[model samples]
Target chain A: MVEQSEQYLLTAYRETGNLQLLGRLYEPYMPLVYGLCFKYYKDEAKSEDAVMQIFESLVAKLRVHEVSNFKSWLYTLARNHCLMDLRTESRVSTVDIEEHLVESDRLLHQQYEEPITEERLALMESCLEELNEEQQRCIRLFYLEQKCYKDVAAITGYDLNKVKSYIQNGKRNLKICMERKQE
Target chain B: MNNNYLIIRIQRYLNGELSREEMYELEREALDDPLLQDAIDGYRLQQRVSHRQLSLLQQRLADRITQQTKERHAFYFGWQRLGVAATACVLMVLVLVLLWMRNHPDPQRGEKEVQVELAVPQAVGIQALPITGMAFDAEPAQGWKAFNAYLAEHMGNELPKGEVLLAFTIDEQGRPAAIRDTEGAVAELLAEAKRLLDNGPTWKGNTGKIKLIFR
Candidate 1:
């Protein structure tokens, strides 16, 4: 739905060669791009500069590239541009963010609207209990009780970072256990 | 959801705008999307993205587009103006040439033939000289006939025997003032030609040259 408008703008810009149309298309993603750049550069000024630079590149790139998924394509473009820039500066250490993010296989790509069966629910409950005490507490509070990470940390008397890790580890363990049970 | 709405949610989440349901919703979705998860982690480290900076960047983009358009328009119109000026110059020259042609036709293309029968003497020893005037280059002078009659009437028996070219300009008083022999005629012939022209009839306003042939 929203993607249709983005595609319309892209088509309009390509046909008319209108920069304003491209600007309108790119404007909505500026914040996301800025945030991604901030993650890499870690400096407000540099990140802002990178955002504008990415936009400058996109003006030329979008014309030639067959971009079907604009959001993900732009994300990949921003990330690779930042990574290459860092590599040119010999700062390989900054690319250490990969492990902190979800690995490809661990991501649950299932649709949110998919129905949950009783068998899966029971399996998930059993997997939930197998986690260690802190993981269980953080996961239950953060997800089941609808508490934010900070609130879960405060309620559970753990460090905020500790609470985040516990919930992450707990979710990974739950997925592992659920897969094992299904097999 | 709209991209702006999603960005606002991300900002609120980072700022701990504790709409717990929204937080849960964002977290649940982030589970399936690695890009969103990474962005969330990045936002956590960076804190927040200011709307002010985003707007400033947008304004800069808009200004760049407008400035490029203005330069293109200026370039296109600059050539157009030069073309218009060149055409106007050509038109004005054409009109002046037309007006000039109407005021002065082709000067009869050749010299006007002076009536020699009136000026030349019919005597056996002396013959009348043809009088030529310079005014025929632009406008034919009306006083050439009168001047020819004056030259014929003033012919004394002691006429010079060679050609004497006299150049003179008409003075403000409507009379020839600077009458001088240009061809270095003999002293007597130069004096006689000068006398004949200095006392010749007045022209309203004309500078003329008349060649005198004495027989």
Candidate 2:
């Protein structure tokens, strides 16, 4: 997965000049990236632009990131970009109503896609809700934002290693949460 | 990873908290560890469900940000390369606007700083003492200036009594009430001892006692 994830990052960085390859490389990861934007800004179009801006920023700063964990790295980048956009926009007006689309997009997208029939999903949502805000945030960044540990750190303003620990702890807790319900 | 270590690490991993090396280590271990694999599977399922819930939220926020970004950056995004002319025009407009606002009559001028005086006097205590008064230089009974002939002879003793206990009573502020048990010369030795002890540096003892033993 490391090798694959790295390959994807390298490809995206190198071939962003080509829209086709750029889309193909990023499309699979879009949900995670978009999820990050929506999480912070809670709007689709703004988050979508956030997604675009993240890609734009990624392309702009492609040469600088010595990515140890590519997925986590992207998540950090996406989360940071979304927050920056949120800050920039705050001085202008309130978070746009379109940003609220994030709530609706979840249901609409789920229904649009193959309905995730797994029974564990319900339990998982419940488990997630039970987590403290920071833990839940860390989890969403990891799975939904597809951010790497270091990236999560950059976005959350935590120490680099603490992000890793939070995700590691969050995962163990989520696993326990799912199993507890089964028992 | 040990079971305990892995449990902790796996939680962070599922939450996307681990670094590249940490993640690789876990992923490598999961290949052989069925328990870990199951854990990952459950977490993956959790991710799917969570992402579904988060998508709507992302959509609405993204739209607002896009509109705002466009507005803030509108000046820079013109379809021509006339950067210098555009910048000059904007700068002049800004200067003129500031000048206009400054020249306009403003209601918020000559506002005075409100002066307030609080004459709350704090009570301070002063204790008066005269030179040669009993407590003026009242110190420890040690190095007593033997005014009497008996104490003068015993002043420089060959065998010095070290830390002998003197039992006595004290009022609330540790002033001696009376000498509880005094024998021989010390029976009438109350005034000097009281003056000395009252103004003396205490070594070790509670002052609020009815009878305090001092050595």
For A50-157, candidate 1 gives per-residue lDDT tens digits of 888888888788777766767767777788788888889887755555544443445334423536899899988998989999999998997788787777878989
- How well does candidate 2 score on lDDT at residue B118? 15
Candidate 1 Cα errors over 4 Å, as ranges: A14-17, A93-95, A100-113, A129-134, A169-183, B5-12, B29-40, B67-215
Q: Candidate 2 at B87: error in angstroms? A: 27
lDDT of 1 at B47: 78
Candidate 2 structure quality by residue, lDDT tens digits, A4-30 = 755775666565443334344444555
What would the TM-scores of all predictions be? 0.54, 0.26
Residues forming the 10-long window of minimal summed lDDT in candidate 1 chain B:
B136-145
Error of 1 at A84 (Å): 2.3
Least well predicted 10-residue stretch by lDDT in candidate 2 chain A: A102-111
- How well is each residue in B50-140 modelled by candidate 2, as lDDT tens digits? 4443445345444534555575477566534477678889999999999987888454442321111112111111111112322223222
Each candidate's iRMS in angstroms? 3.0, 16.0
Q: What DockQ number belongs to candidate 2?
A: 0.02
Fraction of native Cα contacts kept in each candidate? Answer: 0.47, 0.01
Pairs that collide, model 1: B120-B128, B121-B128
Task: Say what the RMSD of model 2 is.
Answer: 30.4
